[model samples]
Target: MHVEPVRSGAQKKEFIYLPRQLYRNSPWVPPLWMEEQNGYGRGKNAVLSDNEYELFIARRAGKAVGRILVYIDRAWNDHFQSSDGLFGALDAEDSEDTFNALIQAARLWLEKRGMNRIVGRFTRWRSSGGF
Candidate 1:
């Protein structure tokens, strides 16, 4: 499997919707659809718009199997004087390889941005408790 940054509109949709497929027949409580869309919109979410962030999708055999969002909250870091990075909205298939690939991608991105510590599951909005 390979991980790619979510770039195109279709990939964004897939990133947002992959959890539905992954959690089908389970007790997952999905976030409101419009809220999810707005959260990812370029200027809709203050948290996302004011931070440095990227969304990624993992694909295997041309099918999406996992997704993640990595971000650096510069304002938070500046306030706390921390070199930390955060990741959230994690959804993945039950495959170790897929999980590793997705996490490594996030790690590398954060490292490139000078983050020394990694904090996670910083989910902003969701109907379910958390990731």
Candidate 2:
């Protein structure tokens, strides 16, 4: 397994595609918003428009198997009085290799930002907020 953080606009789009590719058969998974991604990747997302974020792609045996987005939302921090970092858009194969890659990328992103606490679909608004 290998992890490569995507740093360019074009490469970020590639990272976005990884999830759609993995879950094409999941009917419950709604279609992704490409426009949103373009905006977020290009730093146009209003909420975190000024914050720094990264998209990561994980590969196993030279094949893309997972993806994750790690973001540092400055506004969230200022508003909450905490380092409320976010991990989102996580998708992966069932295998441990795929799971580890996504998490490793997310961990690095948070660790670099001095974020002692983090949130994700596993324990945050990103996955269970919708009603």
Candidate 3:
């Protein structure tokens, strides 16, 4: 298994759509495709403009199997006076190894940015509370 930062257009698309594949048989209702795409677009998302973020994709046997988005919300840190990092948009296969690899990747990225704590699943609306 390999965990890598999403750096290509193809990887970005995989990151955005992984959930649909992960939850296909479940009761989950996937978000609109355009909405998902727009959320990652710098021009369409105010959060992207204000915060630092990275998207990652996990692959096994050369197949994408998981994804995560790690971010540092400046507003959240300022509002709470904390040096914390956040992660969300996590979609992974039902494998512990895959989940751990994704989380470790996010953690390392956050630590490198000087974050002292890690909080999670800070989805779009939840992250706005800091603002």
Best by TM-score: 3
Instruction: Give the Å shift of residue 88 in candidate 3.
Output: 0.7
Off by over 4 Å in 3: 123-131
- Each candidate structure's TM-score, on Cα atoms with residue i matched to residue i, is 0.89, 0.78, 0.90
Model 2 over residues 1-131: C-alpha lDDT tens digits? Answer: 88888877667777767767787887756554766466445456564467777778888888788887788888778988987778777778878877777887787778888987778764324555674
Worst 10 residues of 3 by lDDT: 122-131
Candidate 3 lDDT over 60-102, as tens digits, reads 9999899988899999999999999988888899999999999
Q: Report residue 101 deviation for candidate 1 (angstroms).
A: 0.8
- Give Cα distance to truth, residue 96, candidate 3, Å: 1.2
What is the TM-score ranking, best to worst?
A: 3, 1, 2
| Candidate 3: residue pairs that collide | none
Residue-level lDDT tens digits of model 1 in 1-131: 99999989999999999999999979999989888888875599887888899999999999999999989999889999999898888899999999999999999999999998878885345668654
lDDT by candidate, in order shown? 0.90, 0.74, 0.89
Pairs with backbone N, CA or C atoms under 3 Å apart (clashes), candidate 1: none
